[model samples]
Target: MRQSLQLIFTLAFSWTLVSCQTAQVKTAPEETASASTGQADPSRQAAAPEGGVPELTEDIVFNLLAGEVAAQRGALSEAYDYQLRTARLSGDATAAERATRLALHMDKSELAVEAAALWVELAPEDLTARQLLVVMLLRRNADVPVLEHLKAIVRISENKDENGFLNVMAAINRELKRESAMELMRKLVLEFPGDPRGGYALTIAALVDKDFAAAEREANTLVTDHPDWPKGYLVLSRVFLAQGDKAGARTLLADAVGRFPDDPFLLSAYARLLVDAKELEAAYEQFLRLEKVEQEQGDASYWLGLIALELGRDEVARGHFLRLLEIDGRSDVAAYYLGRIAEQRKESQQALRWYQRVEGGEHRAEAELRIVRLMVATGESREVFEWLQRMRIQYPDQVVRYYLMEVELLREHGTPEQVMALFDTAIGALPDSNELLYARGLYAATQSRVDILERDLLQVIANDPKHADALNALGYTLADQTNRHQEALDYIQRALALKPESAAILDSMGWVMFRLGRYPEALDYLRQAYEKLPDAEIAAHLGEVLWVTGERQQARQVWQEILDKTPESEHVLEVMRRLKI
Candidate 1:
């Protein structure tokens, strides 16, 4: 609403100047001409009485001034009325345009439609005005008028650019039925085949209608005719990819890259396909090549760094990230990765500096967490506490999360009594905080405090019935530490329904099923959960489920995999003790 009002005021101000120019307000023209040569012009103050207002001559000029004043006063409807009157009385195209714009800004669609029609009538040769009328008619769903106005708009300027036509067609697609929009685009294509945009519009229309055969045919023709146009290849490749023909799309991009070797778009497309195919080395090479050609675009360099990191070439990744920081200073992404690299190399102070450099953005929270971890690892417990306290004050909105992080750290390293005291203190300060309640509940589950766990988790559920994490925690606890198998199944099922993709919830559901003696069902869910997460706890569950089902070899293999990842994982140790493997 604010933006609309701003635009209306701008239009009102500009039109007022145009109205003044037309009026040729008697402003000492001879003196003005002499003033051009730096000569002393006659003082225009003598032309009017002192303290007298300058006079408005034309009715159009008067109405324009009134409208400008009305808009400035935030009386947009009054402004529209005045401009509309001027347009009707003087047949002024600018007045009609202003009226239409203001009416639309006010969301008075009917008034906007009427004013837009007037604008087109007053300036039939104005392509922009005709386009506005077409859009207004589309809003009204006046199909016939829309078709007429759209045809006029395209007929006047279809040969100009495909982008303009594509934009109009995209707008039409949103306003009209797909079949109707496709029909209109088909007519436009037939009417202006010379314009590549018309054909592109037809391709999009066919694609929207799910007529993939027609879309491919039109796309092929478009690319064949306009080989230099990169968008054509992109659109065609997208069509191929959408049809699940990744190879076809890859081939198309590779062919395009061969033809347009220096084209960044084609190179990026080919590189991404290679990445998706797990050809990371090839993809990395291509991205490096693209970075050389498109130095200003840090996207290629960013991807190269990511791929290098994934491939464990940390030194190579560091180089690319450093180059990216030089190219795009706005990104804290490079700093975050550099911090991770430093941490991996056991450079604690260097890692801290890199993490500190991440002042803002998506990486800030993770960077702070990394800093806490580094401090804890270096045995600087007091520094970690001070850093967290500063973070709590600096990021007030995230204070609760910071408090929780501190509690989590204590739960891992401090005495159980100390962790419990901290949790109690936090809950007392923010009594209604579901996150604090859930964290305390999980801690209670670890200590076999069934009553406290149930109370906190149930309170969370009472507040938000769809709190999936709390549901999963309560259900897993009842399943693991208690004999309430049926009750556990119910809670875990609810959590699973809320977040079907959550591996944690899936593991809970499988564990509860295993407790209920539904071994086959438990095996299915556990296998799926392990595939998604591969966490130590999930591996424990998967291995136990396999062992129970008489797959002793597979259970050992799963345990070995977990041990290979985390040799001393508590979950793996517990599994070994329980399963006697």
Candidate 2:
């Protein structure tokens, strides 16, 4: 009977356990049904933890059930409250962090802020939360949040990331003010002195205000510290140039070019700097280095040719210019220079051929001038009459000398009445023109009487002070024949000033001195003119000056050169007779 009684109690206990399990199972569906009924406080009745209380008393449970549904429905505020309560109840930091992040994603800005704050607490060194919060705060332009979050990041960041953080602060300061920007950048640079970009930012700020001294100092510091980087040196050089320290800038670039011999950016900058410094020879050498560096024939040849032409090394220039054309590069510019080179060599047919191949513009004006000048110079002016007449129709404003040349030719070829008619046709188009006055000046200069010549040459000088021919002729005529020594010197000096490279002007200066009886000075000027230009007139004048100055050997040499050029010329023979050469 005791065994049966024990068995019956075991059975009753088993049945009681089974009944409780069945009841719990039955209540889970009921709770789910109650939660699904869309009641306002539905979580109050939802299923809780396994074998736990399934009642409406837990505020946390109510939030959990409702929060998920509300979150899915875009109700982020409710979702955050539920996640916070769930976190407190379960004591799960990682789970809570996930829920907080979800809350942020659900369009709950206020809740997102709080969530971020809590997440930072859970994972105090979490860079994601710190960076995200800072970015969010900045996007909203909320100064309070931004400053607070940036401070948090800074405090947490290692000194190595100090510059990185300051980069953000500097950008914010751009919108905020200089004081704020400088405060952040200054501290960052102090802490992270190794970051050259940070130093550049400081320099950039100075450059913005044109503070060259500050910019140069900072840039030089960068170059000193980062000796291998060319940009720092380049930045310093630019700052120096912008401040008008061209010599300083050139020195800096020269050093850079020495250090970084083949760096294209450095080389190019240095070359351009040298050009600005009027160090043309150095610039040419650098340009040659660049051209040869790549063995790029077309480009190298072109730059070399251009610099040669600029320095007046035309024959040497033409070979490279022609070589560039052989490479079939954009040789229009080269073609133009080649034409000028040919014109200088007195190869008019070749010059005309090359110039005619070029299309029209300001570039073609020289070609057009070459055509007329060659015709006039060679006494073939009749062939250019139609060409000059056509130039009058086109480019009316800037026809270089067609009107003047035409007037001269007309005087020679036509009757006075016919010449006057031609002048009437052209003069109306060029009223108040220096060219017209110069044409008239030259015409009057070739006369028996001096009255018209005096008026016209004065008018020419009045119209254009730099009309070197008018100055030279007027002064030389006065000094040689009229004997106005002081006034002649004044006009010759002005002519020399205007046309400093003209051997003719230099010759005029020498002649005026000869008339003044300053023999040594006269010989000095004449010798320079003779060396510069081996022309017959200049040679004759130089020979006379040399004969007077007791330079008989040099005088004979000068006259001999002229005799070869003009065997029948009286000036050479007369000089030969005087020198017994």
Candidate 3:
């Protein structure tokens, strides 16, 4: 029964409290008289044991049952009030703890403070009560009260280990106000000068204050004083790293590794720095050493695989990833990378199986997309489309993305009519979808169906007047395929105003200006677009503008560069033929 009660507190109360109430400020003592009534406070009723409840009267039992039911029904504020009533009536430490957590959940700091104090007063030996009280006090920046609690915690840690105190300070430091925090840490350090952990805290405080020289000085002291402690080396290396002194960090780690040659963490740190520096071979060696020292470390194998992949040692990469998968079954990352390796080796079926094992992660969506692409590559186009349809229903949140993917696949391998039919289906489901409308407009423009293109794009613009891509598409269509140069300029100018840095829109504005015979302005926009996007299409437009502006030699040089970059580009051939080059 005690275990069950503790589980209820842990799952339903403590976890929620910990997320947002890492630390808090203390509050004024609870009112002696009740706010709702002029009667004296009620939680002064009686005491209860730590693990067992006291005998409660009818009213207290009713209120406790009501609080539980209210909490279960998601009436959090109502539940809190009921629990508050129960705490006041019963004077049970358990009731007070529940009230404290509920008040913190409701963000009622004063009530939380009162309840937490009651819990601490009833259960003075309970560290969790003290911790919660200290956190509440810290939240209000109740520095004097906080200092007393800090001293209590320090004493508690001294009975345990100094490292415990240092860890608590580090964990809660982010919530501390800067000056008061540094002052508190400085005081702690002064009081515990012999403790290397305090020195470490002082070093961190100095770093947080951006007093680099002091950080360096204090860090050096910790390193010298605690040569056997790996954390001292790690902290000092971070001090150098934060200041962009990578070489200094590397030198520091190397010196530490020499003294502590068998330290797996020190070796791992050195290997990571080597990877960051792109010294791949040295990093690989360090990881190898680390793996031998700590055989169960999957991260060592994972990094080894990554480095091998980078170096194009595919066989070695495959071995490491396969080993990692055997050791860590939930390694979706290893599964994803192994799928890539299989695809590279032309084992598409094996790759699909590997991708299927990926349940969910950052890589799950990418793995699914890769499966579709690979299916299409193997002439399973119909299968790929059906699979996407099932996935659209399976992952409702990703329906829009699946629709767009299907559209792209149809455009690549199916007829224009097929692409249009998919768009119709998608737009029927989401008639006002800007993405679908914009995609359909671009598709219509490619087919030279200007009326359909204009209708779709105009509908998009009506829905979202600031759609820059739609504006640019409409402008480029008018400028390229019709004699409406001035209308094109209006649309393109609006687009440029909205997205002045858009290279595609800049290219459209340039092309429209070129149609208007404004060669100088056209040349400037084209040059800007070309510099932003040095692709084959942008280069072709830039070369044509240069030729028209009488820079014939410069035009030849630009076209030559494009040909060298993409020797078989049909777009380059069309540009050359149109300009008579």
lDDT of each: 0.80, 0.67, 0.79
Please provide, for model 2 over 410-496, each residue's C-alpha lDDT reduced to its tens digit, 9 standing for 90 to 100. 676667566556655665666566666566555555553356556667878887878889988888777866757888899999999
Candidate 1 — worst ten consecutive residues by lDDT sum? Answer: 31-40
The true-versus-predicted C-alpha distance at residue 72 of model 1, in Å, is 11
The TM-score measured for candidate 1 stands at: 0.79
Model 2 whole-model lDDT (C-alpha atoms): 0.67
Off by over 4 Å in 3: 1-91, 101-111, 122-143, 151-177, 189-227, 235-245, 256-269, 442-581
Error of 3 at 273 (Å): 4.0
Candidate with better TM-score, 2 vs 3: 3
lDDT of 1 by residue, 519-546 (tens): 9999999989999999999989988888
Query: Which pairs clash in the backbone of model 3?
Result: 24-135, 24-136, 24-138, 24-139, 25-136, 25-137, 25-138, 25-139, 25-140, 26-137
Please provide, for model 3 over 451-519, each residue's C-alpha lDDT reduced to its tens digit, 9 standing for 90 to 100: 888899999999999999899999999999999999989999999999999999999988998999999
